[model samples]
Target: MTTSKQALPPVVSTATWQKELAALRIREKAVTRELDSVAAQRRRLPMTEMPDYVLEGEDGPVRLAEIFGEHPQLIVYNHMWHDGAEWQCPGCTGFTTQFTRLLGLEKFGARFVIVTQGPIDQALAYKRRVGNAMAWYSTANSSFGSDVGAPPDAGFAVNVFLRDGDTVYRTWHTDGRGTEQLSHLFGLIDVLPYGRQEVWQESPEGWPQAPAYSKWATSQEIAAAYGEDK
Candidate 1:
C-alpha cells in the first residue's frame, strides 16, 4: 500500500501574503499585551512561607534556603528521574538543556538550579553526561519534590522562590506544559509554519507531524548520536 503526501498551503502573491500577515500581526500584538498583563499580576502574587527542606548536593547536604547563596531569588527546575530507568525523561532533559548556562540569571539576583528525586550520585552523573555546569541536587529523602508539586513520577516543573533575610517563600510554581517556558526549542519552533510538528498541534493541511513524544530521546541517547558516551 502507498501513502499520500499532504498538500501545502496555496501559493499567494507578495501583496496578498503581506495582507494576511498584517492581520495575524494584530492578533499577535494583542497576545503579547495580554501576556505582559498576566506577568504583571504574577509578580504581585502573595508568597507563602516554605519549609526548610534539605537536599543532597555535590558538596554535601544543603538546605533549600542556603541554595539561594547571596541571591534574593531562586528558580529550581524539578527534573523527573526514576530509580531504575536508563536515563531521565527526554522532555525534562530538553528543558534543562536550555539552562546549561545561567550566569545571566545572577544579574537579576536569581540563582538557578535543578532538583531531582534520584540519588545524588546518579543526578551528578547525568549532569556530567549532559555537560551541564549548573548546580544539581537530589531530594531523595525529602518532601521537597512533592511539596513543590513535582512528585516522583510527575515529570517536569519550574518553581520560583524568594529569600527574605533568614526566611524563604514560595513565590510561584508551574508544572506540565507550563514547564515549556524553560524550553527555547519550542519557542523557536513556534515561529515555524509547522510549529513543533507534534500531532496535537493544529498545522496546515499537508504539513508534517508525528505522534507526540514518539521522537523524544533521552540525554544519553542524544549525546551518543554525537559520538559522546554517557
Candidate 2:
C-alpha cells in the first residue's frame, strides 16, 4: 500500500522554475568553490606519527600497519560500541551499510576498514548480522581509537593515515557529522521537499518533521522492514 504524496511546492511554469533553479545554482557553485578551498587546506596539514597499535580481527591479532597492506593510505571508521549493548550503534551501522564494498578504493591505493571497541567475537557477530563486507577489527585492549581522536565515550570517527615504508602517520581525522561523507543517504534527502524530515531542518511551515535521531534503526530492523532475511 502506497501512502499519498505529501503537499509539494507551488507549481510554476518551466521558465519560472528554471529561473529559480539558476538562482540556487549560483549559491551551489559558491559552496563548491568553498569546499574545494577547504580540501586544499586539508591536504597541506602536517602529519603526526601514529602508534603501532594492534587490533583483533577474525584472524587473531594484527598490527595497524598490516591493515594498510600494500596501500599507502588507510581509512578507518571508529564505530561506537557499548560494553554490553545488545546491538551495535544504529548510526554507525547505517553509515557502514552504505559501504558494502571497498574494491574501488584499491584503485586509489587506499584501504578502508572499521575499528570498534567491542570484542572480536561481538564485532564479527554484528558484522554477520548486518551483512557488512568491510574488514572489521576490535580495539577492546588497544588505544587506537583514542589515539585517533575517538574517546571511549565518543560516538564515531573517521581517521586517515599515510604509511611511509613501515611507519604510519596520521594525516587527517573527523568525527560527528564530519563522517557524513561516507554516506549518500543525506545527500538524497537534502533534495527532498521536507529535507531529512528532521525538526532542526529549515523547511517551510507545516512540512513534516520528527525529533532528531528518531528515524534511526538497527540493521536487522531495517532489513526486516524491507523484507530481507537476516
Candidate 3:
C-alpha cells in the first residue's frame, strides 16, 4: 500500500525543517506548562462524599471504596453500554483497551478500572471480546454510573475518586474530548500529518477526511482484528 504524496506538506531542506521544528518546540513547551498548571488546579478542586454503591464485580458484589483495592486513589472510566447489544460503545471500548498495563499506577496509590452500566456478565464478555486489560465492574444494580456522569445509553466518562478507609469521595469527572488525554491512540494520531482525518478537525485543503469517530472499530471487529475468541 503506497501513500499518496499529493496534499502532503511541501518538501523542505533538512536545515529549514529543523529550524521550523525548533520553533514548534517552544509552543509545545508552553502547552505542556499550561497542562501542568491545569493539573495543579485539578488537584486543588474540592471533593464530594460519594455513596458506597455496591457494584457487581467479577468475584461478586464490591463496594465503591473496595474498588480502590490497596490504593487510596482510583480512576474509573465509566464506559458506555447499550442494553443487550453484542457490541458495546466503540469509543469507550477503543479508549479503554489502549490502557492494557496499569500496574505502575499502583506505585502512586492509584488504581485504574472500568465501570459500565451493563450487567457484569455482559461487561465481562465485551471485555474478553475486545481483550481489554483494565479491571471492569458493573453499575447495573445501582445508580453509580448515572450519578457519576455515565447515564445509561448515553456517553462515556472518567471519574477520579479518593478513598479514606471505607469512605470514598468524588474528586473529579470529565467527558468528551477531556477523556482524550487518557487515549494514547488519539495522542499519537494527533501528531500525524493528516491528524485523525476527522472532518471536524481543521486540516489543510484536500487532506484526507472522514466522519468523526468513523475509524473506531466495533467489539466484533476488534475481536477479529486481534484474533480474540468470540
- The candidate scoring highest on lDDT is 3
Ranking by TM-score: 3, 2, 1
TM-score of every prediction relative to native: 0.91, 0.93, 0.94
lDDT of 1 by residue, 44-144 (tens): 99999988888999999999989999999999999898888877787777667666567788999999999999999988888777756678999988999
Q: What ordering of candidates by lDDT runs from best to worst?
A: 3, 2, 1
lDDT of 3 by residue, 1-230 (tens): 99887698878999999999999999999999999999999989999999879999999999998999989999999999999787777788778887877878888999999999999998887788888888999999999999998999998899999999999999999999898887788789889998999899899999999998887777667777652584
All candidates' lDDT scores? 0.84, 0.84, 0.89
How do the residues 145-224 of candidate 2 rate in per-residue lDDT, one tens digit apiece? 87777657677899999999889999998988897756888888787777888898788877888999887676668445
Evaluate residue 41 in candidate 3 and report its C-alpha lDDT on the 0 to 100 scale: 99
Better of 1 and 3 by lDDT: 3
Best candidate, TM-score: 3
